[model samples]
Target: MKKTKLLLISLLLTDFVMLLQPENAWAGDVQITCDLRVLELTSQQRNQIRLRRQQYKTRQRQMNENLMNQNVTDRQLSLRHFFSKSAFDNQQADEIAKQRYANDVRQTVAELNFYHDIFQLLDNRQREIWLQQCVQPAGRI
Candidate 1:
């Protein structure tokens, strides 16, 4: 008898909970899913992409070398501290560093553009996968 009563109560509770949920609760959700698979590429096409990737890698190495090659020419401390003195003599050094920085920036932009161009070759599903992994996008389409 006790078990029968417990079963009856459990059935009633489930019925009451089901009644509390309104209709159309699951209709508002949107899901877009796609498979990501690399398609076949000809040998020539593959070689072209490999060449571009190598070029970007070389530019990255050069930028890193520029930063590593900077010489810290300041040693003595005087009344002419970090900002008080005119940077007249060391102008060449400053210019070199500035040019290196500009080169680095240009190379970075070029690398990103290369990647963007390559991404355009992806299929819709592959593009979605690429976008999901990207943090800062190259820019909007």
Candidate 2:
């Protein structure tokens, strides 16, 4: 009986640890073929792309911070609702969903603009290289 109990406890601990592992841990064999450095950018083009990339990164960071804060606020509100007798606010939920959608749109536009700027900076040969090395293999239609 003691041996059976220990085995069961060990199984439970193993399951718990498996649950905490990231889903991407299973993707160790996946490889990326796109190499941005193959562009062989000139100094001026490199500087321009760097500036645009930095701006895009800053925007993304800001969006992530805003999203984290919003999630915290939502979690707190949910806890309060769970303890209270008040009904759930469907209208407020709708507003939050709208805001999230807007944020997604804004992020997508920023990403598109950043890529467009980088593409514009690339020469004809570089553009072809980017398309072949980065875009085509990624299954871009």
Candidate 3:
């Protein structure tokens, strides 16, 4: 009786642990499919973008994990709450404002660099067609 009860408890614990695993734990194949669909690239273009996209995805995943870890940190959570409350004095407010401006500038620079590379890859005609296809209303197509 004792051995049977121990086995049942162990099985239940194993099942519970499996349930707690992330949904994306088995997402490798699905991610590839999603990337293909979202990028809508030819095979050559896919090959060119694959490494960069993989790196970006890896960085994004790490950032998300870092955010999750931060959420579990009491000090970090308190700081976030404080910021949300807008309780900063003028000096702190100015520092926050400057940091936000710098972040925006960095993001814009990165976007422009990406566009520059993409533009280099496409000729003018291809660029015009791509812009029309992407930007035009669906019904007009």
The candidate scoring highest on lDDT is 2
Global lDDT scores for all candidate models: 0.56, 0.71, 0.53
- Best-performing candidate as measured by TM-score: 2
Task: Give the per-residue lDDT digits (tens) of candidate 3, residues 87-134.
Answer: 666775666567435643544444445445554565566566555444
Worst 10 residues of 1 by lDDT: 24-33
Winner on lDDT (1 vs 2): 2
**Model 1, 21-134: lDDT tens per residue?**
433122111111222223344565567667877887887888778666755444223223634656644765575457646764566566567776666666676566666754
Native-to-model Cα distance after best TM-score fit, residue 4 in candidate 3, in Å: 76
Give the per-residue lDDT digits (tens) of candidate 2, residues 7-34. Answer: 9999999988876554323232122245
> Residue 63 lDDT in model 2?
82
Give TM-scores for every candidate, taking all chains together and pairing residue i with residue i.
0.38, 0.51, 0.39
Order of models, best lDDT first: 2, 1, 3
The TM-score, computed over Cα atoms with residue i paired to residue i, of candidate 2 is 0.51
